[model samples]
Target: MATFHHYPFCPQSRFIRLVLGEMGIAPATVEEKPWERSQSLLMINPAGHLPIFVEEQGLAVPGAAVIAEYLDETRGLGLDGRRLLPDHPADRVEVRRLMEWFLVKFFEEVSAYLVTEKIYKRFMKAELGGGPPDMAAIRAGRSNVRYHLQYIGFLIGKRNWLAGPDLTYADLAAAAHLSCVDYLGDVPWEEDETAKAWYARVKSRPSFRALLTDRVPGMAPAAHYEDLDF
Candidate 1:
């Protein structure tokens, strides 16, 4: 069996897990705290990142996009109507476009903030010295999240889903980050009916059930965290 080292409630970890589930591959799950490096993580990926994918062939894959594509290729997933990438070339371009948007732009503007403060706070130690999450940064993330929600609302209004006609990697990426925030009670679902409806669809996925069940030691989930209908 393949091995995966990751922390629960990690967006990148959740992203690959969902893809693995989609690919019909099961891995031996090992929980890893990435604040400090370990010999095993070093062996898996010299960079020592979370969400490490160790394949049956002993190939270690790092980064979510690369891992997603690798799993899709190896497991014959993300094809036809069931594809995780968009079918049309233009739409495929758009999928990559939004994939970067959520993974990079959203991460820089939003996920960095909330995840740092809420998720990484107690779990992190001062020796890491990246500095404790800035309250201003977290507050800004909360503000930016509202605007991001509005943008998602507008996008969803224009197209049924975040990427295009069918659900794709962008959808999962967006959900992955937002679920991290939503788990911290930071998402305002009431802001947009379309976004809310879209969320319910994302939440109801079989890939998402495990994420909803994740608990972070001292933190309890938000009121609607586990409610599929929410």
Candidate 2:
């Protein structure tokens, strides 16, 4: 058995959780607040990041991409054709590319602003720069998200999944970020019905149930956050 250290609202953490859920591996989880930079977390991952996966052998796999790849090599073998990383070289590259698009590019452009300002700030202490949400950042996030949604729609129009015909880490990564944005009511789902429909499909998966049930204390999810049909 492995142990997973994460923050519930963290998109990267959520992505790893979804991947583990898809693989049917339920590890014990420790909720972490990355902003705190707790010594315990630092000991395992000096980067002070969420989503650290610790193997039973005491090997600590820090970072979401590292954990995802570790799981693919160590646990995904049993999934056969259902492996989240496609076997073909080109397909594998596409999956990694989309993973980067969501986890890195999308996060930097949208989720980083919204999640940090709206959600994390609410829980952070004043000394740590916590206070009222930054409306400017929020507005920027809201405006930028429309473009990403349109991109999702464009991709879906040509492929069954974000990367290709089969579900992959690309979908999980994109859905992870969107789920966080959606939780904050920042995602403009109506702007792109294709993206909305694609999200609906991912949101309805068994692997997504845990995320749908997540509640962030003072901030409740949007009205339609958990609605399968929405």
Candidate 3:
């Protein structure tokens, strides 16, 4: 039994939750306000990041990479119906590459705006800037998302999964980060049919169900959120 310490709206935290649900682990939830630098959260992970997992091993795991790898190697294969990280070495590298693209690159360009404006503000009021969310930044992010989605569409057209032949960590990372954007109806799904189709496949999985249910304060998910076709 693991205890997943999370911030509800953090995409990475939700990514771990989706993995737990897929693994059928039903981890104990410990929602922490990560930006507040709480002694408890920091005690678990001195880095003070959300989704710090208190593992079955009696140690705390920090970051999505660490948690995902731990579960995929030790637990996901046995417990999850869908293997997140494939075994083929070459395929695995592609997965890592795509995961880095979305989790690091996509996040720097997009998630930073929405997550900070919408979710973090509610939890860590102490850390907020005096100015409001920059609509210009938000606009640029939305535009950038179109390009990423197009790239994903290309990948989907060429490969069965985001990373070569298997649905690996890359797929989950993309969906996880995108879910936050989707929650705010920020995704322009109709513009790219191929991207929408690929997203539909990822979001349709049983592991993704819990993430679809998460509701942020004052922000409701779009009507199509629960719709598998969308």
Once superposed on the true structure, which residue ranges of model 2 sit more than 4 Å away at CA? 77-81
What tens-digit string does per-residue lDDT give for candidate 1 at 1-230? 89888887777777777777655678998898876677878877888777888877888888777887776566655423287874578987888888788777887888867877777766776777455567898889988899888888888998878988777888888888899999989888898888888888988988888888899888898988999887
Candidate 1 residue runs with Cα over 4 Å from true position: 78-81, 130-133
What are the lDDT figures for the candidates, one per model? 0.80, 0.92, 0.80
Among all candidates shown, the one with the greatest TM-score: 2
Give residue 164's lDDT in candidate 3 (0 to 100). Answer: 76
**Superposition TM-score, candidate 2 onto the true structure:** 0.97
Estimate the lDDT of model 3. 0.80
Which pairs of residues clash in candidate 1, taking residues 3 or more apart in a chain or in different chains?
Answer: 78-84
Model 2, 102-164: lDDT tens digits are 888999999989999988999889999899999999999999999999999999999999999
Give the runs in model 3 whose Cα sits over 4 Å from its true position.
Answer: 76-82
User: Model 3 clash pairs?
Assistant: none
lDDT of 2 at 176: 95
Candidate 1 accuracy as TM-score: 0.92
RMSD, every candidate, angstroms: 2.0, 1.1, 2.0
TM-score of each: 0.92, 0.97, 0.91
> Which window of ten consecutive residues has the lowest lDDT sum in model 1?
72-81
